[model samples]
Target: METLFGILNNCVYGILALLALWGAYCVILVWRRVGQVRFADEEDQDEFLSELEQALEMNNYGAVSELCEDDRRALPQLALYAVNNRNIGYAKLRRRVAERFQQDVLSDVEHRLSWVGTVIKSAPMIGLLGTVMGMMGAFANLSSGDKVDTVQMASDIQFALITTALGLAIAVPLVLSTASINIRIRKMEDLVGVGMSRLFEALKFAEA
Candidate 1:
């Protein structure tokens, strides 16, 4: 429609829509880091769990710390509890300490990635609102007659079209970002599960 075309011509709305896409690039970088995050292999996880139990019963917090991969080691919660609470039962300590550990890792990686989903879902809707506002401007600009208010009408039409196009542009990438973020989250869950199970089991073995 002529109305739609005229609204998009001004291009101001389009520029704003384009900027919304920057969130997608940010998502991609975050996803890449999520992928880089380390997790123990399942068998290694089980073995480590077994060893961890041994270490705990032996009262060796240092060995427990050494068993953790580097990124995991950075989690202060991982070793701090065992080091601080020498009197705590090994099984209880394992449960509390490892749960905190998993939560910390999730917060660092997968939880942070969730913000991308929020941005992705919101950006397009923002663009759409801009489009609607633009269209309203178009209708308001016209005089009662078909003899148009040409100047204001063109500006209004540009805003409407650019915003709709921009909304779609932002949305497509946002959808992609959401998908990527979700995948990273799943990976984090899987990895953390292995680690936690091992940590708990190792403590159980130490008790037995």
Candidate 2:
């Protein structure tokens, strides 16, 4: 029975470790993704927009396409889409661009963020389970016989406390990271909004 309890406790620790790793991985991926899709600095954004607007003002659709073609940033990708479908009226183009950005870029980020949230919520519960199991094992050892092994009991109690701490440890950082990532996500959305407005204005004139 003691051996079984020990195995169960080990399994719980293993699970907690896995959860911590998975959560960290998700957070890092989201961070990188946000960076990729958004401008890193205002200067870079300004430069890119200036070039794009110049291309548009000159009625140079091919240059506009070339400008956006190789860039992975969200704004450029959307610009490429607009240039490709330039004959579509501005209103339709605007609507479709909004939809495409939401569906393609934002939705994928949101999906990954949801996984991080799941980890945040699950880690604590799993830790509590480990704590409960540890306590039960400790009490079971005590009641099994008058000859209680102090060392074994101490180990069980330690396991309980450690699991509780570890669970909180996993969750706390993720909570903070998730908050920061959310801010970045919002910033990306705002940047995209501003960029799109500029792009559309240029497109309106270019199309005319």
Candidate 3:
């Protein structure tokens, strides 16, 4: 019985370790994504839009196209789409930008954030399961027979405590990291929203 409990304890520990690693990987993914899609300063976006307007007013299609090629951010890319389809009218171009933003930019940038959230929620639950299994094993050993080994029973209880601690250890940091990532995402969304609005206004002016 003691041997069986030891095996169960090891299994629980192994599972908890795997969950910790998964949580870490998810956090890393979120960080990398945040770095890639974060927005630039509002001033920079405003200046760029002003310059782009000047280029469009001058009928410099080449300059407008060049802006698309030179930049990788969502707003500039959306502007390129708008500039390329100048005859499509503001409403249609705006629709295009909205579609592309949802399908390409927002989806791509926020996909891994969902994974981070999954890990944040899963890690603690997994840890709790481990703790429950350990506790169950501890109690089972206690009721097994009169020849119960106190050392083995104590060890089982320790396993339960350790698993609970491990779960919290994985969960708490993930929660904090998730919060930070969410803030970054919200900031990025705000910047992108403002920038896109400005871009569309510039494109409308150019169309006029």
Candidate 4:
């Protein structure tokens, strides 16, 4: 029984280790998002258009270089759609561009970030299971009609609390990360709106 509690303590250590890994992942998510949000912001879009202008004027590909530097994954292609369909009226061009982004790019960002929410919601349930099992262990050890080992009951209680703590540790930042992702998603959606506006205006000028 002594060796068993020791091993269970080690198991708790493993759970805590997983919690640490999740915390690290949240840090990574924030880091990656710093750049992504920059691109998503409509205010930050001038650099892309400026480069595209340079690309057109000098007949070089440096605008492509700027986008690649910022990890602006889909801007170049979307810009191309606007350029190519400039004569079609911006409305049509805008619709086509929105269809592509909604179907593939934005949807992909949403799907990838959704894991944060899933983990946050599930961790507490896992912790509840741990507490229930720990109670069962404590009751089983109470078999004797004489007296229960206070030390054993305390150990079980500790395990229950520790597991619950670890679960919340995993869950809290996951919720924060999901909120950050939602902000980025909205920013990107707004960028798409701006792109459609530009596409339409350019087409209207061409028609005139």
The best candidate by TM-score is: 2
Candidates, ranked, lDDT: 2, 3, 4, 1
* TM per candidate: 0.63, 0.96, 0.88, 0.72
List pairs with backbone clashes in candidate 4. 90-200
Task: Write one digit per residue (lDDT tens) for candidate 1, span 1-208.
Answer: 5555445544445555455755655676666655555433456445655666677788677776666434343222354454455358777776777677556555655554556556666666767776777777778667446667778777766766766677677767767767767775675566556565555554555555
For model 4, how big is the CA root-mean-square deviation?
4.3
lDDT, residue 29, candidate 4? 67
Tens digit of lDDT per residue, candidate 4, span 127-181? 7666765776677678656588888888777777877887887788777766776
lDDT of 3 by residue, 1-208 (tens): 6677678778877877887788788778767766665555778777877778888788787998887666777777777887787687778877887898788767865676677677677767777877787778778877887788778778767877888888888888988988887887778778878877877777666666
What does the lDDT come to for candidate 4?
A: 0.63
Q: Native-vs-model 2 lDDT?
A: 0.91
The local lDDT score (0 to 100) that residue 155 gets in candidate 4 is 76
lDDT of 2 by residue, 98-161 (tens): 9999998999899999999999999999989988988897898899878998898888889988
Clashing pairs in 1: 6-157, 6-158, 7-156, 7-157, 7-158, 7-159, 8-157, 8-158, 9-158, 53-202
Q: Which regions in candidate 3 have their CA more than 4 angstroms from the true location?
A: none
Which runs of model 2 end up more than 4 angstroms from their true locations?
none
